[model samples]
Target: MKHIRNFCIIAHIDHGKSTLADRLLEHTKTIGERDMMNQVLDDMDLEREKGITIKSHAIQINYPYKGEEYTLNLIDTPGHVDFSYEVSRALAACEGALLLVDASQGIQAQTISNLYLALDNDLEIIPVINKIDMDGAMIPEVTDQIIDLIGCKQEDILLASGKSGIGIEAILAAIVERIPAPKGDENGQLQALIFDSVFNSFRGIIIYYRILNGSIKKGDKIQFASTGQEYFADEIGVLKLTMTPKPEVKCGDVGYLITGIKVAKEVKVGDTITLANNPAPMIKGFEEVKPMVFAGIFPVNTDDFAELRDCMEKLQLNDASLTFELETSQALGFGFRCGFLGLLHMEIIQERLEREFNQTVITTVPNVSFIAYTSKGDKIIVNNPAEMPDPTKLDRIEEPFIKAQIITLPDYIGNIMTLCLGKRGILINQSYLTTTRVELTFEMPLTEIVFDFYDKLKSQTRGYASFDYSPIGYREADIIKMDILLNGDKVDALSALIHRSRAQDFGRKLCEKLKELVPRQQFQIVIQAAIGAKILARENISAMRKDVTAKCYGGDISRKRKLLEKQKEGKKRMRQIGNVEVPQEAFLAVLKLD
Candidate 1:
């Protein structure tokens, strides 16, 4: 009989998944009491800084129950919707899940979505009501709410405070009793699904998976069904809370297989790892992620370009979801065009690359997908505003839309509704949550909500707003391609698609931002906004005065030539706007108050 129970902890953002994982780790004695951090599962500095789980990490702990050791393989999943795909893959690796519901917040949209996914997987569902230590964590009421939402028997609910470590043992015991054990052919060919993986400077790749059947030791050859790559298992091990690996992990348990595979591509998430002698078919839906948001990332200093790319590559090795392509803009020097799951995902990547990679980077304004339908029946995908077709040549244009769900105190519903309406959003429905918070749904353009929307939402509701959204579809609207002209010349790098009514407002804002961002040039530079032939807004950047004093004439001639050459080189570094290659500060200056 298998002496292991594999399960994952699922919850919405900040509902205490990592904290619970820490408590479990401590309970299992996986680490010494003195060494425990507040959130040990958040191994990345970025994850801790944001107080959000970005990647899925797992650790195994052995608990002594009834005089027998029970191996508890705990997988921690990101609760943010941007990493929803990772959450789905994480669910696949476990035979069961412990749904963490915030006692005060009750059931959220993400809670429902994750629970639905858990049910579809046919994994035994174990609901754990967390946050019981909070003042608002009314356990009984939350329990009733969860039972009503899931339509499950009340007996299935496990009320526990993962924060206080209260009832944690009961929760662990329930996993052993209620959750089903992994069922696979122990005598058949070896098969395991690759749910997640991480890279260690020491160990090339740690591929996490669940063995479907059959067991082999070190020196056994294995093949990834997805990549069709074969390699000898350098070692097989279980991950403990100490974040160290044990020698040998067995069948029916969640663990990592260390092969010579140095990159993430070799061990694709959702792929099957099996014996080379007998290979199984690859699981579908394990393809590399397609980025929804794209932006140019450049180092604060030009010399850091090579370092930036190398850091990005190393980070990508650990996270396959991050995508990058080389790109250089006249405004921004050598930089990379990066793709992300969403706005938050994009920011997180940039922050992490800087923090972990030890490099500072400047980022360009993000652009969204806009579909152009021309009179000639030509279809185009415009990720950059610069690539947008002439407004006159287009028959019609549609922007991607999302169905947003906002949960907030009832008093702020009116403010939220007004804010959405002003952004061309349409109210779909409104409902009540326990007569205190209201659930409001809206169909809004993805573009409007991509930037500054979260900040605005929090500000409007005094931070009472909590919500999630997914792509609904595309809707036709009166959208115009707004162009930012610098010195009366169109800057292809600074184009945007804005609603016709908001064009002038955004144009003026863009020009103002550019003036502040662009450094004082040797020659006075003018920033302008034009729609085709008409200029909507303009700003003038004054000429910069020579600051160096030359005491020598003949001697300084050589130095002056060098100075002029340096000036020319600096001009060359700037992206060409019309006929001029501007300076680096021109790109950095445009998006700020300074």
Candidate 2:
């Protein structure tokens, strides 16, 4: 057990986390020169395209130090704020973490956020400065920032360039000399913490776990603590570049267990796996995920609802952070109200459903969850706008607020302040981190930043600003549920709860955006944005004019008038019975009203 060192790498997005992992893999000789590729840990196509880690990856490598071989387990974690849940779980399964910071970008928002997560888990921190090969790299500045953030000595921080393979030997030596070996009772009953899982069409669910105590041999009967269902362990193996079957995986080691869990609900991510006969107590350290964004996803064809459900269930096994429940919309038919970590997480899931499962889905407008109090003092949670209570029966609505942290250059601080204030944000505090860097804090509603706030911030700062946020709590607010009515028919899918002060301007933009997207029909279509019974904004698409009057060139004025009146009557009837076919793009346009 003294020879085994388990650690993970945590940093902000694009802070050279994956690049450093690749270098480490090469230094340890885990893969051959010809077989090695960039971002070998990031196997998903979506992840490769986006250049981000969407899932946590774990691999074991053998290293030689001081004439002795040591087994090192490395868990590479995602750095995006949306995928922070993955980072937390990865940090929990390790004894130490490499807090990687970018030399060019310095310590950003996620660097501090992930650092706190590591601190909470009581893990040994090894600070490392990466990307030192860049032309704009500020090694001394980043080292000072790291010192200020973690309070580590100057020599304690390691400086390395992931791209140039500098300081790889030193990093390897630090892990073996500094990080302690995993400690557990090897002779006790089997207790393994399941940190991650993946679904295989041919082999069922493949669970990735780290043994907390005891050992598990191949073909042992195992039981999951959460489900209480027992199954024979069909395969037990350690994770290399590929799955290598081993006869036994003992305590203080990380490996995969295959029990042929074909059902999605049968396997839980954080559940404990123990021997069915001499089961160990369940590990209750992991917390239930609190999703930050809410959206509705429905199948394009209503008949594909069952297939969509199957796809969602399988997807959830891979992404445990996603939460969903059955939902119905008058306009969208049967769908699921999905809770996502953020907008990017929601988009990734939608794309994965289509690209991986071949399931085409429509996503409704994204919003943050709200709490409502009824006139009778009943509390209701409103995730969808349709779930909002009647105006007369409602006491007040409380929306979720978040404490946002923005780290940017001093030049763009003014613009950043304006952007936050425009979204109903209150300035909490501001401080200067360095001569060039300034940090600002604000308190704002979660709903205000759900759309294009990130995009706007990036553009305003010229990609120099880094932002992070956490939910503070709910607060009372004057908000209303606004709905879009087409020809007096309410579209439940287009409804949203908005702040009362900005409703009129937002409604006008939405109505105009919808007008440009919805296709024209024979009859005129009226798009009305309404709050309760009062309409706030309206846009009209005129009916396609026909040549009915062109055929009466020689007719009298009275005959032309008669034909026109008859045409008007027919158009009116069409408007009553004809259904408006809202295209898929129209639903997406609601998210890009700006």
Candidate 2's error at 131, in angstroms?
1.4
Model 2 poorest ten-residue lDDT run: 547-556
Worst 10 residues of 1 by lDDT: 585-594
Q: What is the per-residue lDDT of model 1 for residues 337-397, given as tens digits with 9 covering 90 to 100?
A: 8878787787788777767777778777776777889989898877766667877789888
Best by TM-score: 2
| TM-score, model 1 to reference | 0.88
Candidate 1 residues lying further than 4 Å off, grouped into runs, are 242-248, 263-265, 285-290, 299-307, 544-594
TM-score of each: 0.88, 0.99
Q: Candidate 1, after superposition: displacement of residue 318 in Å?
A: 2.1
